[model samples]
Target: MNVKLILSTFLFGGLIIFNVNALPASLIERDGDTSLGTWQIVGESGVNAMHAFLVSARKVVFVDKLEGNALKRPDGISAISAEYDLDKNEARPLSIYTNTFCSAGAWLGNGTLVEAGGDNGDANFRSGRQTVRVYDQSIGDWYELEGIMPSMRWYPTMLSLPSGNVLVVGGSKAATGINKEAINNPTYTYYPPSGTVMEDYPLQFLAETLPNNLYPMVHVMPNFEGKPIIFLHANQRSISFDLGSGKVVFEYPKLPGAFRNYPLTGTSVILPLSSIDNYNARFMICGGNKAYEITSEGEASCGILDLMAENAEWEMNDFGGTPRVMPDATFLVDGTILFVNGARTGFAGYRKGGGANALWVNENPVLFPVLYDSYAKTFKPLASSIVPRMYHSVSTLVPDGTVLVTGSNPQGGVSLNVKYPTEYRVEIFSPPYLFSNTPRPNIISLQTFEINKERIKVYYQQIVTLIVQVAGGEPSFKASLIHHGFITHSQNMGQRFVWLDVVNVWMDTTVTDQYIVTVLLPPNSNIIAPGPSFIYLMNYDAPAYSGVEVLLNEQPA
Candidate 1:
């Protein structure tokens, strides 16, 4: 029996919903068991989460484009900035004066989320269009950075560079009217107001990619020589750009078939790096489409490229499972990738002139989650979700190893009559590890020394010890720094994963039942970019991860 066929039948045949409180241990022990993972409808988000990021270990901040009175929102709210507390399962509304629709953001070294540019709506055009807003997660406050960006950007992409600065890439001057003739700002600028900016950089590449390349897949990887280079891919084209001089180092071979960017939305993840591979980097792009017709099938092809190889070319792999569009692939703490959300047919977004049911062309929602094993090069379909996360939906891996899946608004505004109506319900997918009877390793404390009398910093190549209490056998742990990117429009800008080097592991002599794990930080910023990274500890089985500890890598200024 084909596993995909059986899994599809199990999903469509109304699989029993397992009680969140009473998950069986047998279900958990099924390692790499797709059926063992389960989903629980935790709570409802009051607003549609067009964009989402894990602000803290316990809190998630979700935002949607400004809808004014279209969607019933709290009074005086121009845009919904809802902070969802994972522990409490409660969402609280925060006031955002600017319209943050189609904006881009990345976490700064200070652990503050810096979002730049947004919609050009009339309501808050002055503040929203060109505004740069920063949110302090520690204080639950928002601050505006005045006069930062050089232009008004909608549908822009923001990436955190290895230099601890953010690079803002291609965006249209206006919203959604993307075409060949549309005005596209093909240059990139820096955050924190870098005096020198690269204007008209790679203008032809962005122009040729056009409407489909709104959110380009950009990865900062070390080349064969270990120098940092930016890999920019959109649609069928890919280019390696040198960061220092703003020149194209090399143009990668075209993707085999179908487009993997916006409208034709797929998901991508930079495969986990390891010492065995000599830290050579590879990227995988999966599931997209070439057209927006209802009859158009979602692309089941996956393209991968090894950046460090001498003559690297995209290797295509066909997944004989469900074809998905607008999917979200989140890199889990254990180095496995969790693929969720998106639709089976039709492109992203709602139809402008179609009738009620046909408002959103993407009908079949890929409810089942797939786990991609980078090492094994295989896809395992996991538990299915009842919610249909298409169009503007977003998903991110929480600190505790659960995937927080939210949002799906195909309509331009709130409409109950549409087929795939606007969704505010938030669901949490508990991976097989969470179902295990074995207790997770608990982090007792993280020891860090103060630098510059201003902030705590983890120095490069220094051994850092984390005190953790293990419940069962001797602990064999892995340290990972997962950067949960600002997710919007199928592009997770600045999303990255770095498997930290383990120096030593031994039991704590002073404290019984407790052990100390010593890990070496990346030798330089090029290997693992310096900024805010969520550090997680996973034991031998890789079953569950301890709550994340935010680590800042900084050299004293």
Candidate 2:
């Protein structure tokens, strides 16, 4: 757990410090007791949340299907969404004219949430299947852009590229029907329409995946040879696509078992990249079900891939105790993965009749959240939630250490008569790190702050100095830049975490109760893609984070 920073002069102008120590080895193991955290019902969301994203440190926006009866404001406008303030524990209705059902979103470099695609609705004007909406946090309102997507996307995925543009990929052309071979839109296109529309960029792998391929897990990986390569997963197949030239680079081995998209939902995360390994990237996916097994139990299998290897192959692991389908696998600030929500049996969606397990056969919700340690390949159970998060549930890591968990609408509508009724209540889960007795590091100021601009911009390979006040012993600080991607259908697109290197750490001689830490930004855009990321400072304990916008400048100044 002890990390020592070694400074060395390199050919380049800036100092090249190596972080030889591995991430705290203690995080690899866990105690026998499962009660390591606490969960509390924070507030009730007025609308059934189908989609949710963090807008800021203290605010979150929730979107739902445009069912006729939407949450209304005082002026009687149909509010399709609501914004919840974490500080006040209050929810206020935000008017959304479009149907955002099954939509996907990613944050732009300027901190705007660029949401794309949706359901067709009841053939109404508000049906926003091809609409592109942007939510500006400063104004606290939604703006429907004049530009629309080339095709209708129901369960699409969006990822922010290092070039500061959003890439829209893989969704059904229609809204209501199940994902059929003919209805799948396997191609991808950029937002703001990339000039010539290259229709049907033949991705045959998508069609082969069939009904379970909706909302394929996608990640904009580190640039390979200066060209951006995207990793796409549907069913068990993993393929790499070259964004620059728009061609399939290569296809890796199929995942061990079970499909990991839509009805057969599981979850995935791009394992944290470390400087020690030259920032090599790895991807891990866990928990799902067989597509045809409507009432069959979920799978406990997990698959990992080292993308940078010469011949990358998926290594399968089954360390988790119970089976879980549609679970939300989120990466914590301290470089660990957390699995929450989902069911133990059956696939996604609610069944009407035919048997006891029918009418939402996916019962037995996994109450406790499990933590996966990539270092030791172990699983540790954490605190459980009172509310059952099913088909349309979401869990997002907020600026503070706690995770905001909410939403579960198994049935078509909000009906209490069903086995798993619609859920609107929100709960927050605090990890054990948040409850530690160690004093948290306070970031008094950043060296890159400019008086003219409201927010600071930390360029690539830039050395950022922080003035901190540590209450505990000598602080062993680690910086994690995380983008909490769009959470829906057990998939988080563009979600990644990278451990920043600490160049120097020393106590300030002039000031009392203060210290100075110099951290290096990612070397290039390939390591950490450009966009809005939460820079979390982890000292002796898991401390809160502040938002920093990243740009794609590769050259170091």
Candidate 3:
């Protein structure tokens, strides 16, 4: 049976809605082997994915730079955007006026995908610097707002704030090897420009980091707008900044070993926050170049910082002997970190080959995918893919518990003949949990709303009862809320997985094979940020077959 698109039907209310079986595509029947899980060339992405995010379970919106993609628009221009259908395993081109090269995005609380910034375009492709585009479901396309941003930004990072706005931060006026003082954009601005607190607030931290601070790893904390703290990691240092005042809340100890932001491109994700840990914030950064100019191998270490610890200090873990440069670290539904993609050598840059051009950093694609058990602090190597996903490659967890992996254009301009050419072939990585003997959990409804028919507004600290069905499993149920944020350059901008506090779980007296689970959404939007969140019901240790997408909010969120 085919996987379904629940988010499309329930939230966006789009035209296409697949029948959700609440079960993952069982690899036992389709793929000949299931030991290392399964990998299949599902389909071709019409555009090379410089940016991608799962808009729904059945569809992914792929954004590319204005390049020589084989897919063309209605007017015959090379299309830079496409909507990929996971159900059909095919992609259809969508309209995008500006180039989205090296751009970043975050999902709004209202379910809008707002993407911003890009490089200068040629005569045909319009420039995207200072441009902002939001996905419009009504038109089934993108609505571009050209030059509306306060200033020009090339590779800015965006994060959804608790207040339902997107914060755009730190890019450069123009693309460079490492950001220079003259070209660095050391400030952050917000979209919706109407009720923004600060516009283009100059951040000295961005300047202090200099040369290597492009696309800083900025995450919204549970600081909640009253104090409002955002963790910013760039170059070798990390800082807690007050978004309200542009002042540093706390400057952290400098991370040793390698630079983890742009060019070097180490990936970091705010680790899954659990109630057991008091929802204390923790960040895990993995795989970056030891030096800006090294092509030998990346730093084989991963760093963890506990924000709420008594005396917060850096804890580094040695990545399973093998080093990586641009690996993507994503949280699985089963509460494990899946580190996939990226090359074992080189930085994140475009080049015909390696070492010749200092910025040329693409070689040796790391075929193996590793899962980091945060609880055990050990890495388990999973199946390796045949495709080489480097440079602009991206991966995100879907509703059916599969990792949708696609895109890699080391040299750029979309050529298929070269060694590591622009890769459009999509691959789905099914972790071992899917094929296990454990029973998969299912979420039936949220209050009055059914699984996939209408939008459900879940508020902060509200005890929402989930009607669930599972036969013969441990009564201990857990709820995992996730957002597959805009993924590009090893940064899943705004990607978050917050463990909902399950208050109680009791077998349903009225219905057979059913149970009533009560979970309190995070106290405020700060914990998970206010936006579209996927709620997964976990049965004991096994993963959920699929998730129910709901708009998670606080006040106006």
Candidate 4:
């Protein structure tokens, strides 16, 4: 990739700059200290089927059922507020709001939340109506907005435009109920001449302008230039809505190679322009079931589509792993798309137990398929989650770069109790490490440093010293020491960089894989008690990405 080309059209404020310098896989983690990994359990009941939204201010929020029976008030879908720590290896919880059993919701920029179709007792209360909820973060509560649709909807597509307007599209509204009218009647939500607006806005909107009667998939374009486009997978149609003027552009491109079932809705991600072609914008869609077995492999469809040019269409492509539907895909800071936790086959259910054509079983393994845009044609099998997850909510990169993954079917949802479990638990992947997972030998045992009060001379030594300290994963000793505080001068060398574990300096001069190095304390040195000093004795190996060993005084044996 050209550096000039990369810097020219940077997104999110040039947060990621392409450099000619090669990146080492081991140290590939995002910008944060690996030592401070933190995660707080926000909801305790196993939340398996939930959705997440990122606030305009970059806060991550989601709604999930509480613990116990899958259906219950207060236990229904609630709002969870969290902040990410770029340096720490974890996420800390801020607040949670609950009022309905929401299946999906989206951030309306200014901390407002727009949710569609959730169960709220009486079976016909909202009647599949589209409800908008505004949450005040400062107060940690929720306010119900007045405009209620006549029908009920679940898992509908909702997006907030850059212009601060909100767009709600097709979803499975109740087949019958009070809100059912909302779904049956599209004119109530769209603009005049097309549809009527129930709520008063600074501007008048038409319902027909929206993708009425369709559960559209809305994704914001990268570089923050284009308006939010809604892909009505239900009708195999796509529409671009310009909120500025309340206009809609239509494009009907039948995806080639497969006949999609009733619900064409699938997950779509904005891939880098270079992934599919040298020119124009490209996106990857995955996890939709087909009525007919189209491919020879019986694998579901996985392909790329060009969204920037005219007559945009889907092009078949290679998949690094098994076909997953409703999988949660997130864009890694390194330009990699990570797909985790999704069902193997169809919408029917989990593919567990012994079956001739099981989509996935325990032995089949639930793995993390990482698609590196740099390696567009190939998908790499990365580490799997500690637990198997399906229909889960995975968060995009926080400012710190760690992915926050939560919720999922505990075990294929085979057990009745396991269905749609809510998860207060979450996990994060530390950035990749440069070195393979090989245990480093304790060649240099003295991994600690301290100051003595007798003070005239500084003393340092290692508990175990090996002859080949600078070999293989051994530390090297060049006698370079760094002190965080204090000063060094001729009368008393200013605080100098010193290593206590480094034993000797004599070693192979040619080898560069220095892992650890130790050194002895200088003579006649004034010692500062409680003040810590660090000495690094290594051949010349660059710092490991993480899991760095730091020696501290009075710490342990």
Candidate 5:
């Protein structure tokens, strides 16, 4: 331990206040070279990024389970959360009083980040099964309220409802290899919950999809008959539930795969929406074990469906010749999907029970990433990484076009010496667009250092003009909005992307290489649920170096 680091940490309020390493050296020297869709090891994280969410363009918040990590709390306990700096590649500790293992989170419509649920913790680790923690990016700390959740949840999915509150669904009481009837918590609840025992609504779909039904996939579909519906996929089944009456409205065709959730996990994402298609949503789920019989090989195919159609059915396709389990599906600014992390064999979770797969459920870390182009309807292999981002790993698309990847611990706790030890490295993947010399657009009008405070507010059926500039010359541009939501367990709950209708674009006489781009916002709140999101400009297929944050239907604070 560096003596300077010890001097940085001292007893304050009977707790240890650990300051920043300020400039911890990265194991790899980032030459700042543009490899074009390459991976770069930037820095290490204070906590394993089992769960993470981008707080701002320059900052990310990483949370893990109460394991034996290297960073400690103000009280000399293992730190399970930290604020990661994307610009300086530095990490600073954030105070978290509860266990966040296998938890769920979402950004409220008001732009507050809320976290919920976790498993029982050790003596030092407080029970987080029913806690709710909200993050203030400005303060860089978590304010937790224990026993606030209606139920004890371990792997529930947290999604933002149309009304601005978060809906936490699914998960179990205990950490079981596969869900069992006794421990299965097949229900959903709200953040500022209704004051009643009946606040937690029962969802029979969860109980029916037993065994491998942890972190059940749920996405808010477009409004149907003036009410919102959520699509839930678990095991091999999929269904649409009406939020108004709490009933399964439609049963879509079943997905053809072994299991799409934990223990053998794949990943799912809602494709980019556009007015040309009336914002008709299409969802895709890719990579997992193909069948129950095959445990060592991952599912080589993907399933997609037009979820809002009257006669919706799943269409399957190959996973670009790659087999993956626990892969992270991230939506990029250029309307392409990037699948990274996970392994080629086995399931999620670490070595547990007595079995051949007990040593580590997963194997052969899928080092290479696959890119899915929705327009071309094809998958392409991209550059590979030297690290194995297997179980508990997560990848997040930052404000910058690059993807920040972190975490991979296949153990009960932090272990340094193992085939796949707990990983603290934070790497960035630059997409191929960055490598090309193609001109990229910059959102010059979006000038804000503060988060939602300075965000451009978009309402229903509104048209907004963004001043975009390109160095090479004036070029055609398109607009898109992405809300990455909370990234964990490959779900990235509440994550959505929409194509903003570019009504008009014309060169600006006042500024060279600058254009006034007018874009039509989503027609209604259903098109983009209320919350903080990112607005991106694309010069053909190349996205701007970074995106600017915007508030979608977020009321004044």
Candidate 6:
């Protein structure tokens, strides 16, 4: 017998809301989990935004933002000893240095912090020299080194080489951050004109090209052979550069979409706890505003890029349902990427308005955790939090596998006509499955189809596979073919199975007994849709929800 078609439905007030809208898409909680606790209020500095680096000894070294050019700037390096209890969430500040502008820096194995920019108290630009400042944490002092690139700089990026040397790349010196022709998408009107492109000025073209105002994000791939490589997004171009010899190793590769929407920042770290195989160490970039009006919404979206390969080629897949900018991201132990504080599209005037009204105003801001499945090439938005923020600091709590997230808009500040208090608030993100006793997954979407219709086929895009997984019990599922355009009652009975896979066959799972299962495609129907089949998972008393997801396999199906 064919399986009786079941469509997941929701209830409102006193009526049943049949979910024809929520099909084929679902989110389930994994048994694994982790968290980052807000333990200590290490001495605070002026409100600032920056990324932190984890040392071999687990020590975290970062530069404190000092008052510079009237804007919160990095004056010197600070060390945070790792003695803080990961469990108790207790922390203490080690030391902080004075006036220094380090657009970027990294820690060498020998205990010295190699910083780009200059030693004099100024932005990477005023110093007019891209030299390395070596700071010894043991003595709380810094020494300057000349003989590197000579000229003023800004937006400098640096990385520690395996040989104890540091690789610094990309920064411009013109009054505007980028070259004249390198204007950001005209939509980001708030960008300071001079800060936009800093290529040529009244003086000699400082160094070489002007500051692209772009991040030359550096990462040492597990297979990197002593060479320093960085993935850079120049405007919308994805290019890879070798820092050792200061040259563009690879020109550019096309992305699924433009890179302007979500620009790359900070460094890439390998996710240690996910079941991900092919992209064992996935590189992530998040929260940059997209070029406006170029697309349907006149807004952009958030996306991630896979940086595992050696070639300059890359792929961008959207995740954040809306556009976000200047947000910080960290990898969780379970392989999930924690996208902390960022601005949602509605809050546009906050940073891009080019006026006093450009501060973020998110009353009751929602923190939406984003999870990326590399194997699946899809993104899911997890539960929300109460942190409304943009340009905040986020780091991984490696020992306990939690993320240490802190700093965002404080109280009593207004942006775009919205007011927020400068916040010293910090919190932890623990997956619900591990922390909550009643792990229940929410139903997100559902869809139904005919078995034999000229157009109702699943193989339209070479997709002939149906995959499903039951969270707690066996999944008793079913499907039926339609005669011409008419529907039929069909049911398939079998022993309980946690998962199900069938080739060119109308099938279902024992939802009440299974955890998960996927549909397998037949080689013959590569370009044709599979016969319509009504799918159902046995309803459970214990909230067993399901939804559909489009898995865009990297390779052609």
Clash count, candidate 2? 2
For residues 317-395, what per-residue lDDT tens digits would candidate 5 score against the true structure? 9889878888999988888999999888888877664333456678889998988999899888888899999988999
User: Which candidate's TM-score is highest?
Assistant: 3
lDDT of each: 0.72, 0.74, 0.80, 0.37, 0.80, 0.34
Q: How far is candidate 1 from the true structure (C-alpha RMSD, Å)?
A: 8.8
**Roughly what TM-score does model 2 have, to 2 decimal places?**
0.89
Segments in model 5 whose C-alpha atoms lie over 4 Å from true places: 1-36, 194-198, 290-295, 352-358, 447-454, 554-557
| Count of clashes, each model | 0, 2, 0, 66, 4, 82
Provide the lDDT at 488 for model 5. 88
Per-residue lDDT of candidate 6, residues 233-296 (tens digit): 4444554555445455664454444333212222223333111132133444444433332121
Let me know the TM-score candidate 5 reaches against the reference structure: 0.90
Candidate 3, residue 451: how far the Cα is off, in Å: 1.8
Ranking by TM-score: 3, 5, 2, 1, 4, 6
- CA displacement after TM-score superposition, residue 446 of candidate 6 (Å): 49
For residues 405-424, what per-residue lDDT tens digits would candidate 2 score against the true structure?
Answer: 99898766666555676787
RMSD of model 3 against the true structure: 6.6
Which residue runs of candidate 1 sit more than 4 Å off their true CA positions?
1-35, 68-75, 124-127, 145-148, 196-202, 223-228, 353-357, 448-456, 543-545
lDDT for 139 in candidate 2 is 80
Q: List the residue pairs that clash in candidate 5.
A: 15-74, 16-74, 16-75, 288-299
- Candidate 3 deviant stretches above 4 angstroms: 1-35, 195-198, 353-360, 473-475, 555-557
Q: List, residue by residue over 1-557, the lDDT tens digit for candidate 4.
A: 11111122212211222232432234233454423233333333233325554332134444443323232335343223333333342334433333234334443323245554444433323322455565564554445543365445443455433333445544444432112334432321321112454432221122332222233445443222333333333324445544445455555465554322112224555453221232234556555545322221222566676666677766776445576544556554334556555545443222344344433321222446454453446666665555545433454433233455665543333244332333445565533421223222223333332221111122322233222222243222222223221100000001112223233333334444323222433221112111223332222323211111222222224
TM-score of each: 0.88, 0.89, 0.91, 0.54, 0.90, 0.50
